[model samples]
Structures are given as structure tokens and as C-alpha cells.
Target chain A: MAARPADTPRGRVPRAEREQQMLDAAVLVFSRRGFHHANMDEIAELSGVSKPMVYAYLGTKEELFIACLRRESARLVAGLAAAADPTLPPDQQLWRGLKGFFEFVGAHRDGWSVLYRQARTQQPFSVEVAAMRESVVEVITDRLDAALRLEGRQVKPDDLTAMALTLVGASESLADWLADHPDEDPGRTATRLMNAVWLGADQLMRGVSWRPPA
Target chain B: MAARPADTPRGRVPRAEREQQMLDAAVLVFSRRGFHHANMDEIAELSGVSKPMVYAYLGTKEELFIACLRRESARLVAGLAAAADPTLPPDQQLWRGLKGFFEFVGAHRDGWSVLYRQARTQQPFSVEVAAMRESVVEVITDRLDAALRLEGRQVKPDDLTAMALTLVGASESLADWLADHPDEDPGRTATRLMNAVWLGADQLMRGVSWRPPA
Candidate 1:
């Protein structure tokens, strides 16, 4: 049998391969150009496909954005899920989870940027983006809840969730900040974050006050 | 004297008033529709002026977006600068600055959203936006440095700055979260943030840890 032509379609590639190509292109384009600045034309161009093919496969720009969000969010959440164990000690669990987060973000900086930064800011796309964020928060909150219980502390779920949001937001902001200054080691970055957060959690658990220096 | 028409000649209207009106409209449009999605037409409509009028006053879409960013960022920085004092204890200074931040966000939600959300997400704007963020971080780092110094801590400036960025980011994210969940009071939001952050700072100073439950 003759080898398949490299340039031509091999009896039409599978849907999965096409979708992955689109998503990979979308993540790269969205990260470099951002959501508002990136056009479907450009995305289609980068994917080496016609605009019609892109629309046929990915639906509208909004749907394409949602698909990107879902894929990236799922990846990061899965990575974090593997690292954070309810049964592990609170400190160790937090450390591992942070390391996982930093590692995921470091490896998939483009995907992370698209999900964390681009997808979040535009309108007509915020509800789904917000829902994705809520899902991530739920995961972090679950680990936090277990950690709190493991520490023999019983805080209100809402309050604990809110605090978890604060921690997660800080890490995200730090990730962006860390991107600019890559000289710092990743392990140290994770440890610093864990220290900043675990320090706060400990005080809250023990009912300690942070008084200003005299 | 006869009253003048509202659409008086450019010479008749003070430049300051006209600029302020233009900025107000720009903030609303940019925040609601995003940078690229927001067109000059809507800004002119919302400002009750013609498209030519907007162009004449603000130059171009890019310039107008930058102007809105500068105005809002200056207002926020000025508010925080007024609240932060290096001589004051870190806790007191942080408490005061956070109070100012929540108040500023509550009153100027549109402008705040434009700066914090819209500007940061879109590219070609990140440079200008990062400057604003850096200024805000400067204010935050000042207080963090003092707080750390008081407890005889010797963390590197970059590390402390990273911590401050994390806190600032958490507050920004929380502010957006609060905007949606209106039942949460703004007055107490700053205090809650302080409790979480400052309490953690205190614990870090003392090297305390929250261990797993037996």
C-alpha cells in the first residue's frame, strides 16, 4: 500500500484530532494575543484550517472559548486533585497542592493564562468563566475543609470557602508575578506560598491575633 | 443673561468637566464590553456626544482606554497613598488601607472593574496596566516591610513583595466576588481581609504551625 500523503487529509482526520488541533491553536493564540484582541480569523489561520472548518468544529467564538476553558480548567484541577489528599496532614497536603499548582501553571503557562486571565475578563463569557472558577474553588475548599477538620477545627463552610478563595487568588496573582521574575526557584515559590497561607490558617485555627508592632 | 445650550461650544465648556464626562463613559463602556469589544460609537453615545467629539477629546480608542486607566488608577493609588503611612504600625496601616480600597471599589465599581479586570486581561494594555499594579504593590509592600521589620523578620524584598502581591490579588478577586454576592457587606469586608492576612503575618513572624489532628 502507498504511504498516506503528508499534506492531504488521511480520509478525513478523526474529530478528536481536529478538536485538539483547534484547542492547541486557541490556547497559543489566546495566550499571546488575549481573548478580546484574538479573532476567529487568526485562530483559524494559525490552525491551518479555513474559518468555516473552525466554526463547524468548534461552534462560535464563545463556544470555542468555553471549550478552551473546560479543557484547561479540567487539566489543572486534575493535577491539583492528585496532589491534595484529605487524609494527609494539613500542612503536607497544602504543600503538595501548592507544588502541584505551581508545577501545572509552570508547564501549562499558556493554557493557565487563557483560563485564569483571558477567559475571565470579557462579557457574554463571564458566567461560564465564573462557574469554572467556582468549581476550582470548590476543589480547594474541599481540601481546606478536610485540613481544618484534620486540625480539629470546625469553621463555617462559607467562611472557610471564602478564605480558600483568598488563598487561591493570591496564588494566581503570585503566578503572574512569578512569570515576570523567573529567576526565583519554583520549589521556593511553592514553599513561600504554603508558608504565607498555612501561617494564616494556623492563626485562624488557634484564634490568634496579629497585633501591630509597638 | 440667557442660559446656554447643554451642547455649548468646546470653548464654552471647561476642559476638566469635558474630560471627566468622557472618562466616566469610557470606564463604563470598557468595563461592560471590554477593550476591543468597546467601540468609539458607544462611548460617544453614552457620553452624549458625537463620534467626532470623542475622537477630538480623547484621540483614539487606544488612547481613550489608556486615559481611562490612568484616571482610575491614579484615583485608586491616591486613595491608598492617603491611607498608608510608613511610620504607623503595619496592622493599623493595613487596616486603614484596606478600608479605603473597599470604599473606593464600592463607590467606583465601574472604574475599578475596568482597571482590575479589563485592562489586565487584554494584551497591548498589560504594560500600562502592570505599571498601575506595580504602583499599588509599592503601597502594599511598604506596609508589609514595616510589619515584617517590626517583628525582626529578614525576608528578602522580592519575597515580601510577592506576599504583598498575593494579598492585593486576593483582595481584587474578592472584591469582584463580592460585587456579585450583594448580601455581603462592604464595610466589614476589609476587616475580614485584614483578619485573615494580618493574623497570618503574626503567625509567620512567630514560626507557628497548625498540625494535623490525632
Candidate 2:
């Protein structure tokens, strides 16, 4: 029988592959136990490596967590980027992006919690996650800007940024809601957001505004 | 000079007033240190009372945290309710509600953190905080539903709920953003959200939606 590559003893396992394995374990532990309660020993055991190896490769728990965050965040960003087609109109682009976001979150529930909830709570990782969130807001803002220009409606830069932030925040909150209610459809959730934000944004683009009654 | 009643020492201080002082200290300490790290001893010292007095008034650390959460959450709810006048049209009601929300959050930044950010992070308090969030969602949903009906538009209950959740979530994220960027005006932040959500909601009520171009 041929020897299985994955079954090879610890020292023989490639560094990159081993690192990936450790991270996979780390995500599960951190998601389940949170950053403070999660420990290295369990992560090592789950990764089929020893404690010493985890420390040697990943440095500290904080670094390991950051690595997990970066990995998961990159995956999400990559997923959204791949799904968003610049050639498409801004609404379609947004729809695709929202769909991709929900699908990624639904598929990677643990990753979603770790990146969105757990990382957000802990101080050390908040800045890292905030940067990732800012990039997302920037992407959405750019899309909105292009869309507005296409309609020949020029909005203030700050207004555009604020609108983008609200959209991102709304989507994130709905995504968390979706996570909690396992049976809910992500597509439907995405559609609901689209209906709520995009429709309003469309009206604003056309100069239709809702104001307080006199 | 007559000794101030509050300075008459712990045993003589009015129980209700003492409780409020302890909660004030708890909010500060909890917001600063988070739930797990916050201790009753510091809260007591900060409140100008003994640790036993804190225990007598607020109970265990978990109970005290919950007390702090309840007190802060109640203040916010009261502030919003007081600002929302039922006689006003729906948009204005929302505008006022949003204004009230931002003002409350802006004024009670520490309380906002304790209620929204800090309480949400820990396991024991998440459920408690979530219930508070649901009530807020419920209030918004009712407002949205009333507005839609008044416009003679009919929408699914679930869709209305989802929209309300999105609005609430968006406001929360922006409020956090407001917390970080202290220079930003809360009124403007409220206006920005109103422009994004209320306009979008208004369009949806009028049966206008943005769809991808063919």
C-alpha cells in the first residue's frame, strides 16, 4: 500500500500544509471558546501537532489568532472581489457582492463568527478587523460613487462614505441575524437589504428625498 | 457646613441613590476593562462605597453587570421613547427617533459601550443584551409597519421586520463609528442614516426598486 502523505509523521509534514492545519484548528477553537478562553493546547491537539510545534510555528496565541483572522478575512475579500464584476451596473455589482457575502458567511459560519464577532470584541484584534471593515466600506463607496456619477447626480464625498458605511453595517448585522437563524435563506436576506438600502439610494440619486413633515 | 447626604457614608446613603452611583462606576469600569476583567472592588472604590455595599446593592459581578446593562439600556430606551411623538408623521417620527438615538449614544458614550459593545462580547450577557436589541427592533418594525400602512402599501410582516433590523444594525454600526470619530456631528450622522434608510424605505413603499440593468 502506498504511504499517505497526510499520515506522514510530524517532522515530515510540509511547513505550509502544517501551518494551514494549525490555523484550521485555531479557528474552530477560537470561534467556540472565544479569544480569551481559547487555549493553545487544544488547538495543537486538534491540529495533530504538539504544543511546542504550535508555539514554534505560530509564535503566540495572539499571532495565531491574527493569522486566522487574516486568512479568513482574505478569503472573504477574495470571494467578494471575484463575485463583483466592474462591467456590470452598480446595482448588479452590489447585488452580486451581497450575494457573495451571504454565501461566504453561510458556508463559513465559524469563520464569520471569528472574524465578525470574536475578533471585534477583543481589543488586540479590533484594529486589524477594523482595517478590513474599512476596505470593505471603501469598495462599496467606490461602487456607489460610480453609480451616482452614471446617474449624473453628484453627492458629497462624506455623504457617499456615510451611505457606504451604513450599507456595510446593515449587511453585516443581517448576516449575523442569518447566522443565528440557520433556516433563513441568505439570498432572501441579501434581497431584503438591497430593497431597503438600494431603493433609498436610487431615490436619492434621482433627487427624491424624505424629510420631516413641517 | 452641613454634610452632604451622599457624603454621610455608605450605610446612611439612600439605597436608590447608592445603587445609581454603583452603576455609574460599573459602567465606567466595565466599559474601560470589559466584562471579564472588571471587578467589583474597583467599582466600589470608584463609587465611594465598600465592596460589601456593592454586593448588597448589586449582588454578584454577573448580577452587577446585568444591572449595569439594564440601567443603561433603560436610559436609552426612555430617551428614544421620549423623543418619538406618536402624533407626528412616520418619517418625522423616525427622524426624531434617529435623532434621539444619536443624541443618547453621543451623550452617554460610556453607557453605549457597556450596553452595546461590552455586554455583547461576553457569553452570559449576550442573551440579555440581545433581548434589549430585539425590543429596539420591535419598536422600529412597528414604526415601519405603521408608515407603510399609512402610505396604503402592504408588505409582508417578515420583510418589514428584516428592514427594521437592517436599519437598527446600520444605526448601531454608525453609532460605533461616531464613537470612534468624536468630531463627527451626531445630528449629521442621524441625517445621513435617515437619508439612506428612510428614502429607501419610502421608495419601497411607493413600489420603486432598483434592479440590475439587462
Candidate 3:
């Protein structure tokens, strides 16, 4: 608690700010090296904090991993919700939402890939990923519901859930691919998905079906 | 190596047949109990084989698990490839393919859920899941390509890859949902995805876009 003579200036940094820096460093290292192979010393070095200090703040390796999962999940959920304006047209809203999601994944591809791959499949940690996914699905469902209501159209709750699930599933799949392909453009990926799903949604909602060409 | 007089009745069962029975038991036990909770004794009991025989045949627990994965993955991939006939129209082919997939997952829901959850995110085991996914993606891509060619329309390989990824991802997402919801019918699930995606694919391929309604 006491500031030594050598720790006066930067040591004055708030605990919260220092924690965020450590998380950022953790995300970077975890994404690059994976959880098992990653070391605390590297994370500390990256964060410019002492190893002892890192331990003091984050507790342990397992706890630090969970903390990273929580922060990353929160960031993804927040980014998605903020992307679409409620007042916008349905298609525009969907477009913005998809764009925001891919852009976020593209920017943090390594982190997203590592965190998602680890948490979604591993026990105890998967809960964090599930929570994030549920939040995302809810956001999309709300947007679609509001958009439908604007057109004086209402669908069954089951139908809405299925639609949201479809979009979410497809987006997650493509996002996984995007994460692996660094050369791929996030905006373009978003646009490609928008083109397919938006078109399909418009048709399906109106009771249209795709028949084989004659 | 010597067959006892007491074992004479069913001991005539061929080694391959007995191996198949053991594998069948392993799949059932693994699906129901999971790798960690499942014990070799239950599998041996189900197969009507002794614990030592099971161990001798399958080698070890980890090896048995991998064998189960290989068998399951082969079954799934074969099911998908066999579902769609080349003579059928593209839409029919796609419908059949999707139906086959959902049906396979439905029949083996517990197995798929546990195996996919465990393999896709974990070390070593994930390779099995990855191989299965690759096979599925390839099957879908070939179907799309052949169908497009029939109409004298061909897309860039990247576009095709993207399209295939979209379908694979969405189906997987919904499939995961189906595994959890035992009351849901896989056939109906397949139809739902077919309806949405087939419509989208047709329109998108022909240069049609969904514009926001005024």
C-alpha cells in the first residue's frame, strides 16, 4: 500500500486502470501462446507490471484465464449491441449489427479464436462463452422483433428464436473462418453474410421458398 | 487363445463381429456417460465381453475414445455424402443432404453433443472434429459447385467456400440446439434450414439483393 521512492509516479496509476492493462496483456499472450503454454512472466512483461504485482492483482493462472474470458465476452456483447441503432430500418439494423460483430472479431481475431475455442468446448470455462452467446442472441432477437413490429407483422416467438439461431450460428461459423484467415476483410465478410441472410430473411418472412430452376 | 467349453456357444462369433459389438457398446456408453464418467466395465458388460478382452482389443481408455470418434465421424460423413443423389435437381439434392445431416445428428444426438463439445475445443481430440468438419464442408462445396454448373452458372471458389461455411455453421448451431432439445424433430429442423438457406442461395446467385422496404 505504501509507495516506495522508485514507485511514486506510475505507481499512482489507479488499481482499475492497472487491472485493465494486465487483462489486455493477458489477452494478447493467451491468444498467441494458448492457455497451457502461456507463462505469467510474459504477461507481466507485456503489461509492464512486476510478476508479483500481476499475481497480487489477478490471483492465479486459472483465475486470470477466466477474467480474460469475462472481459472479452463483455466486450463482444457490448460491441454488437452498440452497432445497430434501434430507429434504423430492419435491413440496415441487421447490416450494422453483422458489420459490428465481424469488425470486432477481425480486430481481435486471435483473442476471439483462442477464447472462443477454449471456453466453448472446455468445462467450467464454457459458461462464460455461453453467457455471451445468449446475450448476443437476445440482442438480435429484439432487433428482429422490433423491425417486424414496424411492418405491422408479428411472428411466433419460436420462429423468432429459430431465425436468430440461424443468423447466430452462421455468423459464428464465418467468424471462426475469418479469425483464421488474417488476409480476409471483416467488412467484406459481414457484407457477404448480409447479402445471403438479409435476402433469405426478406423472402422467408414473406412466405417465399426457393425452387430449383426449370 | 483357447476357447473354453463353456464359451463354445457364442464364442463362434468372429473377431470382427465381436469388435463391432464392443464398439457399439463403447459408443452407447460414451454418449450416455461421457468419457470421464464412463467406465470400461459397463462397455464390457454391454458387449458381453470380459474386461481383459475389452482392454486387449481396444488397448486403453484414450484409444477406445479415439476409436469411437473415428467410427462416428465416418458414419456422419458417409451419411451426408450418400444422402444426395447426383441425378436429383440441385434443390432436391440440398434438401436431402440437410435432412441426412440432421437425421444423423438426431439419431446420435448425445454422442455428437459430447464428442463435438469435447473435441472442438480441447487439445489432440479437436483434430477429429476438425477432420469431420472439413469433410462436411467439402461435400457441401462439391454439391453447390455441381448444381451451379448445371445452370451454366459458376461462382468464385472463395464465394463457394463462404457459402458452404455459412450453411455448415448455421446447421451446426441449430444442430447443437437440437441435441439439447429432445422433443424437437430433426426432419422439421432440416426443413427449416432448407427453407431459409435455399431461398437465400437462389436469389444471391442470380445477382438479386434484398433491399429495405420503404
> On residues A12-82, what C-alpha lDDT tens digit does candidate 3 reach at each position?
78899889989999998988898888999999998888899999999898899999988887887788778
Q: Which portions of model 3 miss their true places by more than 4 Å?
A: A1-11, A201-214, B1-11, B201-214
Looking at model 3, residue B77 earns an lDDT score of 78
DockQ of 3: 0.38
Checking candidate 1 for backbone clashes, the offending pairs are none
Question: How many clashing residue pairs appear in each of the predictions shown?
Answer: 0, 1, 0
The C-alpha stretches of model 2 lying farther than 4 A from their native spots are A1-14, A28-51, A149-154, A201-214, B1-14, B25-51, B60-62, B113-115, B151-154, B201-214
lDDT, residue B178, candidate 2: 79
- Give the TM-scores of the predictions, in the order they appear: 0.73, 0.79, 0.87
Candidate 1 lDDT over residue span B76-184, tens digit each: 8898888877677565677778778888887766666656666765556767887888888987777676666666665578877877887788888778766655577
Best by TM-score: 3
DockQ-derived CAPRI band for the predicted complex in model 3 = acceptable
Candidate 3 structure, TM-score to reference: 0.87
C-alpha RMSD by candidate, in order = 7.3, 6.8, 6.4
| B1-214 per-residue lDDT for model 2 (tens digits) | 6767656755677789878989889888988887778888899999998898789878999999898888877777887777777777666777788888988888877667656776666566778888898888888778776666766666677877788788888998888877777788888898888777756633433334332112
